[model samples]
Target chain A: MNPTYFLLLIYIIVCTLIITYWAAKHSGTTKQYYIASGTLTGYQNGMAISGDFISAASFLGVVGMIALRGYDGFLYSIGFLVSYNVVLFLVSEPVHRLGKFSLGDVVCSRFPGQKMRLIMAICTFIISLLYMIPQLVASGFLLRLLLDLNYSVSVLLIGTIMTIYVVVGGMIATSWVQIIKTVLLMSGTFLLTLIVLSNFNWDLTLFLNKVEEGTPLGEQFFLPGHLFNIPIEFLSLQLSLVLGTAGLPHILMRLFTVRNTYEVRKSLISATWIIGLFYFMTLILGFGTVALLGYEALIAKDPTGNLAAPLLAKVVGGDFLLAFVSAVAFTTIVAVVSGLAISATIAFSHDIFFHILKKGKTTEREQVRSARITAFIIGLLSTLFALRLESINVTSLVSMTFTVAASSVFPVLVLTIYWKRFTSVGAITAIVSGILASFIFVVLGPYVMNPSDGLFKTEAIFSLYNPGIVTIPIGFLGGILGSLLSKRIKQKETDFNSFYIKAQSGYSSRGES
Target chain B: MEEKLLNYIYRKRKRLFIILIFALLFYFFLPLSLIFIPEIMNKPSFLFNLPWAWVYAILQFPMTWLFCSIYHRKAKKDEQELDAIKGEDVN
Candidate 1:
């Protein structure tokens, strides 16, 4: 219908082609395909990690939130960014070293049987599938907004192309694509921010004065009560954002892609620089959205207030940037969804199918085949998820998924790293308990209540922002109790001390064995 | 023995982690401030007004190294010790 839409379509095609070519070229060994042969320098992998982790939700959604909710949305940006250190401090090294490929690999490698692999994969799948739904839905909505395409058409197009990308290239193609996506996304947001600022007199007082007079009473830019309710809502929202960031699977898994611990620390510092600056721009977007569209207009456009950013793009940047913004939003979905699929596939194939079920007899080619097949299956299932579930706001959906992940996964990881007495029972119990409690909370908790005030009822017992105050402790308790009930597997316990020493020394694979 | 164990973790894991995190925490605070800026001020202030998303996107490169180096040494240490201890290869 429009040049922008056509350009977006062209861009998607070009990305798909570039990935396919790289897939064919580097598709040398299964190892290379699945884990990028564990060879990429920290810098290259870091960019890909950022791209894969940022997602449509972080890119389009958070900025929109900052635009709409002000400080509340920036809370999410802060949460996601802070968890990098959490990932680095607690989980990254253990996760990377323990298993061969996926999170499933790490968890199951420590346990007794196929049951554990299947369980971890299911958790990964459930949490990942929940995390993935918003990406797919965001894609469909952005396409609808930009190309004026139907929802199913947009989704199907994304699904098909993503499947091909993984089926051919595996993780290498996915990582490379992610790097490119990061570049495109960063540059796009920057240009839009620059243009938006140019409109202002480049002075704070003048901008606020203009906003105050033009806007509704108390609805001024940067003022309190624009997008979020204060105090209770603000506090809960902050917790949700912070805790949830530490929990996201794509971000945690990024730890496995790198070479060493120093890289992890160094990369985290640099990432924060970018992350902090990014959240700052998001607030500006919120103000820009408020100035152009107003509260009434944002409410009218999307009752849930999810489409505020894209609509803001239309206001300041014109229809062309609107289309470009929408396209970036859609591609953000593709990049994230594809990475999730690859991760889930690797977890399922290496950790479960090949290791436990096949008795580790499966060949490299077979494992690769299984990974591709798993990717295809997960993509279809997520599409089905999108089809079946009622649409939720991207912001809330992300936080819910994060709460579940942090609750279930974080507790076990943290305890195991520090506590010597922790047992297998503790790990299992904690995992099961965290997932179950948070799952129930997300599904039936009162946090999604009190719809009378806003478009949706979201006042649960614990505000939906962060459920960690409850969920995290429950997990630690579960681990401790499980350890107590189970007999101390005393011999391995003693030997594990040496194992612990080996794990820390960093040069273990060389001499001792 | 107890003191040695305490010193071991505090000297190595805990101390190392504490140092690393202060650096990493920048991701949250800085990006938040960048956007935080435009809110308090009328015209987004000096350097504070810098667009956040592009900067973070570019900054990811260093964070990668931070994460990887940390994981590599830690993982290497764990892996070597585990192999020497030589338990059943459960998988």
Candidate 2:
């Protein structure tokens, strides 16, 4: 056993457990448990948001993707960064004003019914689980490679720690874990970038030449078409990534962690800066992997390229640097899964249990108790799912999650806030159709149904791996059609005038016609 | 006065929508350019002897930072303006 890696992993676990211990004292109230009672400053929440957003997929998978696939892999990072703009411009402020603890609160602000809450809760549960499975799957691979543990055991270990973090400490602990993880991840990646540049004597031209020389594609490495053959697939993946962030339930839940709209702006701007800078450093690190380690070495070590960053660290700074980077990746997975688990817990306990089942009559003590129970259940379920997904590349599952989010949650939120004609029927139709369409597309698509390495030994019915181009439009259409159809019945028109005013300016006055 | 406030809100929405459209167009240009005009994107430029495609992709980082900064400044100012309008109505 490697003592250095073991010590570093132990250090991170101890530190997070201490944070959980401290947070448990403060998280007595439901508000504190769900969103830390909205006490964090703008920049702090921004760091936590970045921490929540960047997972093992971005840290380990994307770097390896770029090293192997070249230019096309970098496109994935770009799609992720650009999506924040959609969040900032369209949904951030309204989400802050409307949602208290969950996406259910945000949508139910307009619809105001148990049916609406149930729909949003189901969407939140599915999205969080979809996102969490990837983080668990990535950590399973990481531990199996590092400590030679069985994949299922590794997944279960992480799942148990994550459940403990959320169940005991709740959002406060999750936020601190993510914030600390952001610090560790940024510094680790920055230090690795500096080491890579120093190795090349800080020369750009020579570095570029080496990058081309190291890859098999040679000069063509700088161009596209390596990762995707069809142009539509490239466009489809980009569309999903660009629109997906605004729809992510965990990311949306982060909006309620701040005080006001001004802080909301600060949060998005700071998140943009940190996320933007992180992607740029990852670009250099990706290029460094090719320049320093060569393409064949990276592929030989891990064909999926998940080990590119850590292996690059080993070649440059020896076993110590490798251990440090691996520990950072481990913490990355832990922090992200904790964020996902808490969001799912809040969805179940707050939206489903308190609003729908209990009719919002439960005591705070009982609410928090239900939240802890939900966290445990979600953790166990995700671990079981992740164990079966060990053979899959971590990056492939990520696009499916984004596609589902972009298709379902995004259209519903946008229409609810921006489109006054949108009705409850429309919201329900949009969500149900969006989820079904994306799920069916993924199941029938090449990712699941391919002949060689897929779950099924048949040709894919839907050719495109990411079918965002079709399903996103279908989501919007379902909402529009449902609203128009329900309009002819002359149903009780909801108070769109006041809801729109409050959503925009955070205040609703009676005098405004 | 209420009409005035509604007008202001309407104007703000229009302006924000315009900016959204502009930003989306700029962001989507990269993938579209790669697909429709590979010859232009692959051509090496003078700065750093990198291809235009690489330059375009790298520029998106600065573009995101710039847009976010601009939106932050404008939205903060708009919040102040909104409060001023409300304060005037109270008076």
Candidate 3:
């Protein structure tokens, strides 16, 4: 490893240790472990939330997409930014007001049963694992590129660091790390954007022309169909991105870290501003990469263009800048993977162990202990899986998680909040059908069944790469059809009314009978 | 009085939902519409150097932020009004 790479690694390690050591005292109780005792201010929580939102996929993969595909990659950023509207307008308040620790808490609060908790816990685990795999894979790839480490060693290093972060400091440590990561990421991108613009004398049109000159497609680089050829595939990708964000278990869990609904609203707005600006800067970084290093150079460095940002750093500022960008990228993966591990751990310990198996009677100490152990297990499992699936494109795998989330979790959460008639049957059916439909579609889709490299070695039967367009409707149908067909449960209506009042009014439901 | 409060809440919810639906449709309209009018994608819209497709994609960032700001203000005002109505009932 280069000396600067060593220094960057040491800096990250020192920061990680300080954060964990500081947060360790606060994480002794279950509440602190799960939601940081609901003490974070709006800005802190917002930064943390945005930090979680802008993961390795957005920092590296999306910029890579923009570098390679131009306009199409920026379209992905727009989809991601707009999805915050779904959270702000519909999901955040209710999730904050009603949930205690996890998305399972919000869903099960209305249903009031172990079955719903169990189902939610399982879904959260699956989604969190799927989300973590891409982050781990990306980190491994990044380390291999930057430090010349073996891919397996890189994966192990990331997995171990993330597990340590969660197991020692839980949500407090995770949130602090995320806040720090977001700041570093935003500043890094902003500075890079400035440098790129300054290179072209701050003329966007001139920059565009230079970028066009650098590519074979020229003016066609600004068009949409280069990356997503089919119209439905593009539509499906957008739909997944917009809806899947609200469904993400880890993101939803962030809402529970705030004090109340009002803070949740404030946090969402703050997160939106930060994330939106960061994505806008990504456009400059992406196109700037094309202008500075050219698409051919970027593709030569990394075929997937994952190295566009860091490689651009090298072109503009040499090895020192390259080391800093690489470190920030590594921090991005660590922050996201830590967040994912904690969410999955919460699902296992809080939702399943305490609520389902132990009947919510376990001591807080035991709950925290269980969460730590679960985090370790999940970290190990995801690291092993990441090692095995080292060759898949990171962004595509990340998009699949979004598609699954949009299909399964988004529909049920929306129905539970808005529809008074939504019953346990509908929620359960939506979760099950959403998972099954998206799974089946993805298995039959091009990602899995393309003739040359696909698992089955046959022509893809499913034309669309993303299942969101089809699966979202199927999920809603499962919920609606199940609710309509089932007998009207009087208790469920009453439960809905109470939850609705609290969710809408931002009132505490604790003292209510 | 409680029934009236529920109605008020319901009406506000409906208005918010309408805004949300409209905003979402408008945001999605450009790209989805481009599918039917593929020829438009090639034409330069704003800056002569950039094509309509690029303009649409880039414009979405500002448009999304605009919608978010508008919705946030509206939602906050509605919440305050709801709180006022509840306080009136309690008094």
Candidate 4:
């Protein structure tokens, strides 16, 4: 264990804990604890959104993928960047106006029943928990690499820190942590990119040429289909990545951190620009890893390409740069897991405990206490799961998480907001069917059923690794059909109209405007 | 007045629908073209002997920004118009 790496790691921990201490003082009320009373500016929330979205998978895995798999790796970045369009053009503003604390609030705003809230809360809990496990697993490995600690110890350490941040500081601390993470990630990646370019004397043509020569793919390095030979598989993966963000609980939760629709738009725009630029830098960094570090060297160190960024850093700037990049990756995981923990905690405490158990009559103190307890439980559960999952290939969990969100939550949220005939039955059907279809497909697909390395010694039934192309359409269909086939209740005169007006123009009849 | 507002929203949604169609098609065209028309995508561009696939992927950035800017401006204008309508209703 190098002293420099340990020092940087300790510095990040201390700084975040200090921020949490300050935030704990401010987050006395439930509103403050949940969304900082919606006080963050557009750009501030935007930075936090980026921090929440770009996890260790993108930071470490994408670089390695690009270096090894060539053009297909860049496709992942494209899918991630374009996914914001779905969020911006479709869901962001209305979600901001409708929801207060959790996704359940957004849905139950229309349906206004315990059943709807229960469904939304469960979906949020599942998605957040699924998203959190991979993050803890990644951080465990990263910490092990950084400090040579046992994997279990590292997982426990990160798990404790993330729980502390959410339980104490709440959304304020989560937001600030995410903001610092985005800044560190952007600067470290940008500096490394500039160094890579400077090493090649800042010549684009020469660098591209070197990249082509360095990789085993030769001239085919810039061509697509290196990783995905089947066109359908690629399209399926793209479908999920492009449509997944709008349904992500933690990402949608960030919308409530800003005040109004205006800031919602600003937050999305600022986030788009930041995310776009970061992906662009990653694109360059990916190719630079190939051109500078070479493909053979990268594959030999780590076959999965997760270490491409730090390995390239070490090559260019020695141990100091490697430690810095590793620390940034560590922070990426921590910020993301904190966001996930908060989302899951709110789903349980606010939606379940306060709304269901107390029937919406809980005190603010009790609600806040419940949220803290939920965060602690979620962090501990995830840490325990991560310790067991050390041997599994967790990279697939990223896309699996996306596919699940794209199928279930995406369809439910879209129809809830846009479709007038979208009833509670339809929403429930959409979410349940979406979850079932994706889970069944993934279980039957190559990830699980392969005879050689899968969990079961059997032949695969479903072939598509993503299952999004099939499952997403099934989700939408399930909602539409369920709505159409349901027994029509007598329509309320002003229900759909009032909800539509407020959803579109942020003008509710409660007379705030 | 409610009918008029609904009609206005319908028109706005129509525009959004059209833009979304075009944006999604344009975004998916890269992968589709690579699969069905690899020769064209693999050919070097005039920019720097780089493959067209690289250029195409890079262009997604500007296209996204432009589309977002267009929508932002339109949404802002729509918000002001709705506010004006609300003012009229109040009066």
Q: For residue A502, give model 1's deviation from the true position in Å.
A: 3.6
Best by DockQ: 2
Local distance difference test, per candidate? 0.64, 0.89, 0.85, 0.89
Off by over 4 Å in 4: A489-494
lDDT tens digits, residues A1-513, model 4?
Answer: 789988999999999999999999999899999999999999999999999999988988888888998889989989998888889889988898888998998888888888889999999999998889988988888778656788998899889899899989999999999999999999999999999999989999899999999998998888777898999999899899999998999999999999988899899889989989998888888999999889989888788888899999999999999989988988999999999999999999999999999998978898888888888888888889988998765756777889989999999989988998888888889999999998899888988888898887789898888999999999999999888877485422238887887777777777754
What is the C-alpha RMSD, rounded to one decimal, of candidate 3?
1.8
DockQ, in order, for the candidates?
0.11, 0.76, 0.63, 0.73
Candidate 3 wrong stretches, greater than 4 Å: A392-396, A488-493, A508-513
Q: How good is the docking of model 1, by CAPRI class?
A: incorrect
Ranked candidates, highest lDDT first = 2, 4, 3, 1
Candidate 2 lDDT score at position B79: 85
Q: On a 0 to 1 TM-score scale, where does candidate 2 land against the true structure? A: 0.97
User: How much lDDT does candidate 1 score?
Assistant: 0.64
Which residue pairs overlap in candidate 2's backbone? none
Off by over 4 Å in 1: A108-113, A217-237, A390-396, A447-466, A488-494, A507-513, B1-10, B17-91
The digit string of per-residue lDDT tens for model 2 on B18-86 reads: 888878898899999999999998888775777888889998889988888888888878888888888
Question: What digit string (tens of lDDT, one per residue) describes model 3 on residues A72-188?
Answer: 778888888889988888888878777888888888778888888899999999999988998898889789997789999999999989988998999999999999999999998
Clash tally, candidates in order: 59, 0, 0, 0
* Model 1 Cα lDDT, one tens digit per residue, A1-513: 787668776877686677767775776566777777777676776677777777776776776676555544555665566566566666665566664566666654444456666767777777777778877877777777666888888878887777777777787888887777776777777787787677785765555454455445443344334445434444444444555555566666666666665565444544555555665666667666666677678777775556777787888878888887777776677788888888777767777788778988967778777877888887787777765553655545666677777777777666665567766677778889888777666555443555553334655554444455566667668878888888655423333454454344332333442
Which candidate comes out best when scored by lDDT?
2
* Residue A109 lDDT (model 3): 74
Please give the fraction of native interface contacts (Cα pairs under 8 Å between A and B) kept by each candidate.
Answer: 0.06, 0.64, 0.56, 0.54
Better of 1 and 4 by TM-score: 4
